[model samples]
Target: SIPTSAGSESDAEQLQEEQHARSVLRETFLRCLLSISNKKVQFRMHEKVKVDATFGASDIDVLNFQVSDLHTPIGVQKEALIRCQDVISFTFDV
Candidate 1:
């Protein structure tokens, strides 16, 4: 059954609240990323692989990360792009 406009005022208020919450969360996340920028970070990946890199920037969608001085088992890469899907976890000092 189609919902009438009778309850739309309440529905609109609820939607506005939800939008505000999402905006706040996104802003916080962006701030966190800013703090990590230009910092050394350790990444834990699948297959028990681990590496270190200087954080650069992440795409808006967070599909990948641009990093510098990536230290891998083979050697150090001057610059690289890491797929977020390949990363299990990452950490850095505040």
Candidate 2:
């Protein structure tokens, strides 16, 4: 049971609306990622790791990214799956 004290319920409704807006924004971001498929992108991760790879696709939950030709210190991997949690951000040319 929720207490309705001086417009508290309205405050809760406003919070719910804000959450829905955030969800829509997140879906839009995921769609943007999909639109950038097969493009060369640069990723920045922890430990100041920066590498380039061909963007394939990300899981529905944005957990992991399927990529190819992952450039690393040792060598470039022919195929790779980068964990999204490890990535700070990524960028590619429009």
Candidate 3:
């Protein structure tokens, strides 16, 4: 039979808390990325813009987003241009 000790229960609770913390951090990082993307889009609409936004856990993955805009006027008419790239890679251990 397994022993019902206070230490074991405490260990289990600690592990659960760690897992929850990791999950919350991951979610918050993702939300930050989304906000950065939106800001990049807004910047592109107005003028020629370039931005690099990077985020994420070291062991999991590193995300680098590059955004730019190129405007080409058509016969003296205003034009709009937008470009974005999301580059991701495994970086280092956490």
Residue runs of model 3 more than 4 Å from their true location after superposition:
1-7, 41-60, 69-94
Instruction: State the weakest 10-residue window (summed lDDT) of model 3.
Output: 84-93
Q: Candidate 3: lDDT over CA atoms?
A: 0.41
Across residues 1-94, which tens digit of lDDT does each residue of candidate 1 receive?
A: 6656567688879999999999999999999999999999999999989899999999999999999999999999999999999999999998
The residue-level lDDT of candidate 3 at 48 comes to 47
Whole-model lDDT values for every prediction: 0.96, 0.93, 0.41
Clashes of each: 0, 0, 0
lDDT of 2 by residue, 1-59 (tens): 66566667789899899999999999899879878899999999999899999999988
- Displacement of residue 10 (Cα, Å) in model 2 is 3.2
Model 2, residue 3: displacement in angstroms?
A: 14
User: How do the predictions measure up, each by TM-score?
Assistant: 0.88, 0.75, 0.39
Using lDDT as the measure, the top candidate is 1
Please report the TM-score between candidate 1 and the true structure. Answer: 0.88
Query: For all the candidates, what are their Cα RMSDs to the real structure?
Result: 3.3, 3.2, 11.8
Order of the predicted models by TM-score, top scorer first:
1, 2, 3
Off by over 4 Å in 1: 1-7
Residue 94 lDDT in candidate 3: 28
